[model samples]
Target: MSANDPGHINDLSKDQEESLKNFWISIIDKITNKNKISLEDFYDSTYGNELFNLFASDNPDVVLLRRLRARKWNVNLALEQLINTLEWRFQWGVNQLVAKGESELSYQEILTGKTFYIGYDRFGRPINYISVKNHIKGQFPSETTEKLTVLSMEIGRKLLHCPVESVTLIFDMTEFSMKNMDYQHTYFLFNLLQNYYPESLGLALIVNAPWIFNRCWYIIKRWLDPVVENKVHFINNIDELTKFIDLSNIPKHLNGNKPDFNYIPPTEQDNIMLSAFQNDFSGNKKARENHQQASINYLRITYQWAQTNHNKDLLEQRKKAMEQLRDAYEQLIPYITTRTHYHRYGLIEEPIFYKTYQRIQQENQQESVHF
Candidate 1:
């Protein structure tokens, strides 16, 4: 980290940079038992498995920041939280869940369109809608619904581009009643987001929350982390949401401009790559190798960046390696995981996906001045 460039990676301040570096060092030390070890070597070891690949696919710096922010920049606590999350994921077989792709959950869950990503907010964060009205207690098995939620989070992660790390969650509570209330399900979700996916939620809007939800919310709020609880807002009307989301992005059922949720089943064409390479073991092996090498390269660069005290040149190299890793992961997706609605419709490729809050704000200001 150059002294002149305090916000070198992801616009982090000097203190924040120091904390992030400390976190990296601490985790590395734990993994290496205080012995010096190169990142490439560790990445090749048994410890650096699929979960490590998952973290690499997600920009590791951003992932670290998410945990740090969740713990208010406390390195030790963030480390604990992250370790717990990794342990949970391993125990819960999250890698297999992701590897199995969209089919792991029942078709009924997909048809209900209970949860899905739509358009993004003004700041380019994807908006994930949870159709509370469609969900009835015990309608689906606990494991199935949990998997659906994890799949949704995994998809949401893909939608996030740089400078837009979180997603807005709208729990559309229109026509909500006592039968729709699932306290256990709600607890699992909030706990998962707060602990495992810290800072992944930008905002949560309880839209059209029925009068019955009041009692339920009182209990639910107690289960949330203070930071997460603060992000939850009750929206009585669509206009109130416009402060964050443009009307064009909101669903029409909520009296906004966009159409309601529609589930598009994955067609054969959607899995064209998988179909093409199904029997070609050599091709799949090569793709996996490419992705693995790219991931290791990223970790190697990141380790150098940290060891060099965040040298400006090493930071740039780290960034380039991160991009290479992301590209590799995308190339490997078709082979490793099945295509979801986001890929089929190219939702994440929309122009809005590339915009940052600063760019959007500048454009909005220019429009206001023109008027």
Candidate 2:
């Protein structure tokens, strides 16, 4: 064979090409049982085949077949089905790439005991196919809440135990719905997490809808304290949120106290004691702390009371009340800092945080690379 000859390396003759095409046709026919299948069935059975053939062929019938196949099916429907299949395959391929990347990255991070924030969707759906694929491959935290809580706890544990100072708790709130939001639905939902764990360094609540941000604020503020209000944040887009997260001094604020339970801070000691006694600790430590702190920090808050001549005994009572106020903090501090009481009361088991973190990180990386 000449050095430049194309025939040198197992080049197929015309007859062989014809025979191979016949063989493939026979295989396809056998697969379809030689049945006269409808265009829908053809597209369904052999996805994008007709389309591919039409693109490759000079025959008019192939183009006609595509149009005929698309008649009963709306453009969107046909397009959607084809796109779904393509997307699925693309996702699968992307997932494989992610798996390799994650194995390398996760192994390194785990070995080094490094803390990294992995963002996840609300359902703990893999943010990327690779994470999803690896999760499916490794069978990590199967349930959504379990996965998220486990992720949270893993990061929390790492922060608590390792040299890592903090962890990023990233979540996209685009699909979050207050109407469908349930506290106990999953083992590690957002609200349940707020109740169960301390607020992390910061939270990235990705809100594409402005109204959703308001709703999320309500749900989060229900459990977190005013101090940690800065920790909870809202962003209109992922890019904005990510940028803000990097800046580290993004502005955040409380949703403001509810009007129904609104009360002015007590000015006198007697009032503070009465307020403390009547204060509701219905939610978690964060809520209770907000109430307690609001009461103590603003001891001079004015409230309407029947004006009466000041009495000496009443003044002493106020002094005693002030003493009681000082004592309450000593008691409340431990309660707030100790293990969350609700966590023991049928709160879901500790979630698999590290696996979730790894899964999310892999997913995000896959998405960035693929889509």
- Leading candidate by TM-score: 1
Estimate, for each residue in 148-246, the C-alpha lDDT of model 2 and write its tens digit: 333434324322311222234444333444543333432234433333232223343433444644654566566554544565555565456545343
Give the Cα-based TM-score of candidate 2 against the true structure.
Answer: 0.25
Q: Estimated TM-score per prediction?
A: 0.86, 0.25
Model 2, residue 301: what's the lDDT?
Answer: 16
Clashing residue pairs in candidate 2 (N, C-alpha, C atoms within 3 angstroms): 150-351, 150-352, 150-353, 151-352, 151-353
Residue pairs clashing, model 1: 1-309, 1-310
TM-score, structure 1 vs. true: 0.86
Indicate the residue-level lDDT of 369 in model 1: 100
**What is the clash count of model 2?**
5
